[model samples]
Target: MTKSNFQILLADDDEDDCMFFKDALDELSLSATLKTVRNGVELMDFLENNLSNLPQVLFLDLNMPRKSGTECLLEIKESEKLRRLPVIIYSTSSNLEVMDMLYCKGAQYYIRKPADFADLKFVINRTISLLKEKNVQHPTREEFVIQT
Candidate 1:
């Protein structure tokens, strides 16, 4: 899809965070459409059902209930149909080990959820730009985690 009409899917449990994310996207004035799921189970179901019409990017939260983002990421990578879809780990966790594991598991990038709305917008915009420029190619370890 074109940059003006980017499709984004977000798997996050917190209502406040979701609101903030949507608000940030709105404030940024990018013509991006966002779809959100409450947990990993829903996220997987959505992806499975929309195999032919997948989003340009998935912003996945790590600490969801029922099914964790790690499980979802593994399943996505294992699936032939979903393997190429870009997944950005949007989480609060800054644990290096977890980030490393996620990067190894095929996540396109890791973003520690920014506290400020401006930073959030910046990271999201930067991520979209990177995905557009890189075409989902795995970056080096040094560039795996995006710090805002």
Candidate 2:
């Protein structure tokens, strides 16, 4: 697919992580268009205002200033217009308890941010590939987290 074919949204407060994510995407040459929102508030605003062009998937960081990913997740899932949108929890923490909660709350997947650039690319690739499958849906507990 071309860059315009795959649209992705990322909501994270970390400047460095956003840069790293874009860099990994560049290195992979996967033709994915990524839009970054610094925090959950911005993410929600974008999502609400851009109803005509909703992203194919959202990569959300669990912690952010102003509003948290948990809050955003809840809001998104509660919205009839946004509930079907796939959300991938991209966070630094690997707290299984929190992950379980997020799953029950309706997030499609949880991905622990990879420290290595190559691993990050791999994880992103895997995620995009998996999402392309017709049968792709909320994963089982054992398959929820994308371990790169």
Q: Name the best candidate (by lDDT).
A: 1
Cα displacement (Å) at residue 88, model 2 = 0.5
Query: Model 1's lDDT to the true fold?
Result: 0.94
Per-residue C-alpha lDDT of model 2 across residues 49-123, encoded as one tens digit per residue: 998889898999999999999999999999999998899999999888999999999998889999999999999
lDDT of each structure?
A: 0.94, 0.90
lDDT string, candidate 1, 1-148, tens digits:
6967799999999999999999999888678999999999999999999999999999999999999999999999999999999999999999999999999999999999999999999999899889989888999999998877
TM-scores of all predicted structures: 0.97, 0.95
Clashes of each: 0, 0
Off by over 4 Å in 2: 1-4, 134-136
Please list all clashing residue pairs in model 2, or write none if there are none. Answer: none
